[model samples]
Target: MSKPSGKSMDEIVALCRRRGFIFQSSEIYGGINGFWDYGPLGTELKRNLKNAWWEDVVLREMVGPDGKTIEMVGLDSTIIMHPKVWEASGHVAGFNDPMVGCKTEGCKRLFRADKVFMVDLGLDPSGKHVDVGVEADSKAKAEELAIGIAKRFKIRHDANPNPIAFSVLEEFAEIPTDMQRFPCPNCQHRTLTPPRPFNLMFESHSGPIQSDDNKVYLRPETAQGIFVNFLNVVNTTRVGVPFGIAQQGKAFRNEVTPRNFTFRSREFEQMEIEFFIHPSTAKEWYAFWRDNRFAWWQSVGLTSANLQLREHEKDELAHYAKEGAGTSDIEYRFPFTAPGFGELEGVAHRSDYDLRQHAEHSGLRDKMKYFDQERNEKYFPHVIEPSAGADRGTLALICEAYTPDPSRPSGVYMKFHPRMAPVKAAVFPLVNKEGMPEVAEKLYRELRKKWVVDYDPKQSIGKRYARMDEAGTPYCLTIDGQTLKDNTVTVRYRDTLQQERIGIDRVGEFLGQKIGSAQV
Candidate 1:
């Protein structure tokens, strides 16, 4: 099928709010800066996405690289851990971002140094484009600045009248210290300060006494929790090397700027797997996961055109992954990063760095090693980590499923996969009279027992279908006058709009066949 032209972020955000998908946090109190709350539909959609991941990664058995069944296990870890855990994991000392603050009198906005870009404003006295720099936090903001400058100066170019093209001159960090004074993004003055290292972790006191002794931090990633419990899992379960520990939980990062809706939220959830393997098999396992994860996203409905798997370069490798095979990222072309792409998930080969660190810091060096009875040797197992952002995946799904069609009653409909749709099927009565409501209500109650179904007795049949379309409901079953005699109802497919007559008693089987095992 041909892909539809991309939709703007504004359109997607408006649909989300109108359909009760997502909402700003604490809107009554003017809202928080870097947080969001998922509404009923959004909550169900997210839950379905996470459940699908858990089922596919942990519960289902798959063939390994050696053509044998691989073992997988699940874990649920706490959000807060011992402070030393962070120290061992290198987060306490080095989990920082280069931050710069605007020194303008009325605007003291903070920004990540690398995120700040310098763009050409094309404002020159001689009617020629100059290289004078204007700073902005993102490419979108940079384009906005270009338009604002053009309007302010009333400069029009005959060759290209639509605001001369602008490109990022350089990053804030690349500028020399002597010439670091750039215009602030907010106030548009040369009052920005030099970049400094700022920790991204959120800190709090564990007890009533607010002191350094009881200082604690919210976890910044879910991978560490799996690492800390490596030995416990090995000892408790009958699994050996070449197994994985999967986890899904909340993680917090105090981002300097969270502008891309839920894409860069300060608080979010993650689906991570720390797959342990023999040192000799690190390369093979890394390749397996990189290919496997890329396919998994496509199976869940992300199109191949918008999804890509990119291998990291030497300079881009993380500290722990430097000695390993390498790391690969699965990127999605979000509306904000349309021409380009943003990171959706990363598959990295961590060469026993986490296990070694936790072992040394916790004074359990021997306990952290895995015993290989076949080889009669014990050592720290190498890990292949597949870490994905749950919120980012949810956002990607919403963006991909949005389809605009003027032929439909609703201008736009969410073309979600049957397994991923928030509402599996919606039930409606053809009319209010002739006992159609009774039949529709009974069908709705029966389907709701096993799936998330909707029943609407009000409004016209066309309007009900439109509402379901916006909600991303895959199938709509309507009871007409013929149903009272024939015991059959019309099942209207959401995507094709084709209808088929099926017995009312066989509705559950029809949904089960269409939705697969996603049903309750």
Candidate 2:
């Protein structure tokens, strides 16, 4: 299927508001940056997205090698864990974004250094297009990307020398600079200060003691919690190597700047899985999870053309994705993201770094090893993590599903897969009278018990169907005089606009068959 052209963030935000999908958090108090609240429709879609993920990753067993199947277990860990846990996982020190603040008076907004460089180059603030160093560590690679961007954008040291754009960009890439300054992208003034490290974790005090000694942190990623409980899960579930622990929960990040609506929120939900496997099989399992996740997104209705796998360059691999553990991202063509694409999820081979970290830090190294009865080997299982943002996933779906139908004036409808649609179907009485309402109401009530159904009796059947279409309802059932005569009704499919007549008694069966288990 051909993918729809990019939809502006403004247009999407407007639709979300008009349709009650999402809203600004605390909007009455001028709203909060990097925070948002999902409305009725948005909440339903997000919930359904996570539920679908759980069903696929944990509940449903998948065929494995030699026709064997792997069944995953689910996990729900606490949001705030031990402070030492952060120290072990590396979030306490390294989970940061280089921040460069505008030094110009009256404008002191901090910008992520790479994003600033992107804007300086007359492009989207996402740096997905400019590949600086694939094999370099984060800071060094950022610096390299800055230099390449400087040269490409022709940010001449002589022409815009005083702009200090290149200098500021380079400095921020490596370290927060207190020495050099640059022009502010927003103010166009030379009020940019040297970059500084801003830790993303949200820290809090424990036991009413506001001191570092009593500090705890809201998790920035869901992976650590799973790692921390690896032993517990094994002991309790009797699951061994090659199993997964899937979780969906809220994570917090003190983002430098939250732009593009809910794409970069400070508080967001994540659906992640930490799949454990024998160390020797890390790469193989990595590829398996990578392709599996990519295919799963397509199965849920994202277009294949708009989705691509981006291998992490050797230089830019994650600190943990080392020594045979590889990493890659599934990128989607989000209109506002840089170069027209952004990461929807990441699949990483973490090389047992996390488990090793926890073992060493918690002083349980010897006891932390997993005993594989099948192989008679005791070892720390390497991990392949597939982590995605629930909110971002929904946004990607919304962007992909927003289709324009030229058959109607000002026509646009969400072409969601029935599985992801918030409202699955709508029931409309052909008219307000002639016993049609009686039959429609009965069908509506019955379908409501089975699906997220809606009933429309006020407007003409045509308008009602249109409204349901905009809401992404997959099927609309209309009851007219035919239903009173032969107990058959018209069923209109959303994407095709094709109609089929079936017995009223068989509507449930027809929908169940069309929707299928996953679609339902």
lDDT of 1 at 247: 99
For residue 159, model 2's alpha carbon misses the true position, in angstroms, by: 27
Off by over 4 Å in 1: 1-5, 96-197, 517-520
Clashing residue pairs in candidate 1 (N, C-alpha, C atoms within 3 angstroms): none
**Stretches of candidate 2 exceeding 4 Å from the true structure:** 1-6, 96-197, 518-520
Model 1, global lDDT? 0.85
lDDT of 2 by residue, 1-520 (tens): 2224645666777888988999999999999889999999988898888888988888776875425687588889999999899999988877665667776678777676555642223332442322221112344444455545556544443332222123344544555453233445555455566666778899898887688789889999888989999999999987878888999999999876788888889999999999899987876788888888888888788864777788888777877886666788988887676356788899988888999999999999979999999999999998899999888899988888887686953377888988889998888899989999999999999988988888888976778877876788899999988889999999898888899999999989987886664521
Weakest lDDT window of 10 consecutive positions for candidate 1? 160-169
